[model samples]
Target: MVQNLSTLQLLLIVGGGIAYTVGIPVLVKRRPDPWPKTFGYHEIWHVITVVAATMHFTAVSDVLA
Candidate 1:
């Protein structure tokens, strides 16, 4: 386990990180306005990030001895 997280956990953490890096920036291009007060797409991205992190942390299992 790296940093006490198992292999699968690490993969998920890394995958999520990659997805966040590639996904969030493209949000602006996907939408015509990309305004929080208007369409709220940016705000939705932020919420997705928070939820992903929460799921990763909560789902991490203990390392086998």
Candidate 2:
């Protein structure tokens, strides 16, 4: 159980980092225009970040528990 949680935590952190660093930048460069009242790539990036953080927190809590 501990080993599984550790692996999951590591994967989430690395995956989130990659998404933030590479995926978000690519999307921003590809679509440099805001769609519908200033909601743009940056906003999308933030949403993804929040989701990733939430998932990470959940995994960590589970591991600790």
On lDDT, the leading prediction is 2
> In model 1, which runs have C-alpha deviations exceeding 4 angstroms?
1-5, 26-39, 59-65
Report the lDDT tens digits of candidate 2 across residue range 5-60: 57777777667666566546646575554673577766766676777677677767
Q: For model 1, state the Cα shift of residue 3 in Å.
A: 10
Per-candidate local distance difference test: 0.62, 0.66
Every model: Cα RMSD to truth:
4.5, 3.8
What TM-score, over all chains together, does every model reach?
Answer: 0.45, 0.55
| Tens digits of per-residue lDDT for model 1, 1-65 | 47777667777777667757655765766543457576666666666677667646644532332
Which residue pairs of candidate 2 clash?
A: none
Q: Model 2 — which ten-residue stretch has the worst lDDT? A: 25-34
lDDT of 2: 0.66
State each candidate's clash count.
0, 0
